[model samples]
Target: MAHYRASESKREQFRRYLEKSGVLDTLTSILVALYEEPDKPNNALDFIKLHLGAAGPDPADVEALRTEISELQQKCEALTEENNELKNKLMQCEPAPEEKPAE
Candidate 1:
């Protein structure tokens, strides 16, 4: 049997949750709040610090995490859109088959 590293497992879990998290809104808010510093590393790190409730990360690690977050954001937007489309289709669908009167 093979084993996965703790970090790898955590990343997988993060990816799964991110797929469902609708992160674009949060990211957009962060970008808007920071206004003049959208790509400024400090701005992104500050937001991460607040939500993560942790001290600052190493610069290299923060850069990597930001990249991961960006990819996750894209995934989330796609999922959100797909989810809405599916929901609309479901709302338009007919009811399921009816059971027999006695059988």
Candidate 2:
């Protein structure tokens, strides 16, 4: 009775919100494109995700970035070691500070 009416009202409101936001149109267009394709993609889900811009970065691009990061990390480690060695040398060359006597 009243509960059924309330749920129906909520459903109508949600439908109107989806229509106003253009989500319905976007999804419809993507589905139409998929339906019209001459040679269907092997992975239909991937096709949809790719069309929706959620398929993530290209594999080649990701591999190149990983290689660059590894090279940079090695270079950073070498530079840190060199800096520590220089600091040790500087400390050895500099005389130690003397403590002042209390009156």
Candidate 3:
């Protein structure tokens, strides 16, 4: 009975500390956002980590990176086509070497 009371007291103290530090409020807001999402995430902890900015870059940044990647891919394709065309043109312009009559 004494150990149970001590544990309860510790839990209450930790809760108070979280409230005092505004962590409770922040967590509440994140939870509310998670609750309101149309497609709820399968993992609550992962959702919370992403919302808290612990997972990685922001969504906007990710979108920008995706756009840049698409542009680079297009540019690479165009350059590859151009290189192939130039090689074909060079091959057509080159003549076969003449063979020597005697060694």
Candidate 4:
């Protein structure tokens, strides 16, 4: 009897924790949205995940960012080559330092 009472107490605490944390409310809202959809999604899990923002970023946004990164990488490579060439030219123009005679 004492063990059963302890289990019930733990369950109550967990339920209260969920209620206090707003998780219950968020879940209820998502379930309600799913319920209200007319043409229900084929995959209910995916729908819930999408609603909860766990499905990852939008594909179009990801593609756009990838394109931007590629362009920036190409530009960086060009600038690096130009800088190396300039450094080489500067080295050629500078005279070599003469070594001092050993004491």
How well is each residue in 1-103 modelled by candidate 4, as lDDT tens digits?
9999999999999999999999999999999999999999999999999999999988999999999999999999999999999999999999998899999
Instruction: Quote the positional error of residue 28 for candidate 1 in Å.
Output: 46
Predictions ranked by TM-score, top down?
Answer: 4, 2, 3, 1
RMSD (Cα, Å) for all candidates, in order, is 22.4, 5.5, 9.5, 5.6
In candidate 4, what residue range of length 10 has the lowest lDDT sum? 50-59
Screening candidate 2 with a backbone cut-off below 3 angstroms (N, C-alpha, C), the clashing residue pairs are none
Residue 63 displacement in candidate 1 (angstroms): 0.6
User: Worst 10-residue stretch by lDDT in candidate 1?
Assistant: 48-57
Q: Report residue 44 deviation for candidate 4 (angstroms).
A: 1.2
Off by over 4 Å in 3: 58-103
TM-score of each: 0.36, 0.61, 0.51, 0.65
Query: Which model scores highest in TM-score?
Result: 4
C-alpha positional error of residue 15 in candidate 2 after TM-score superposition, expressed in Å? 1.2
In terms of lDDT, model 4 sits at 0.97
Tell me the spans in candidate 2 whose CA falls farther than 4 Å from its real position: 72-103
lDDT of 2 by residue, 2-102 (tens): 99999999999999999999988988899999999999999989988998999999999999999999999999999999999999999999999988999
Tens digit of per-residue lDDT, candidate 1, span 49-80: 66555766678999999999999999999999
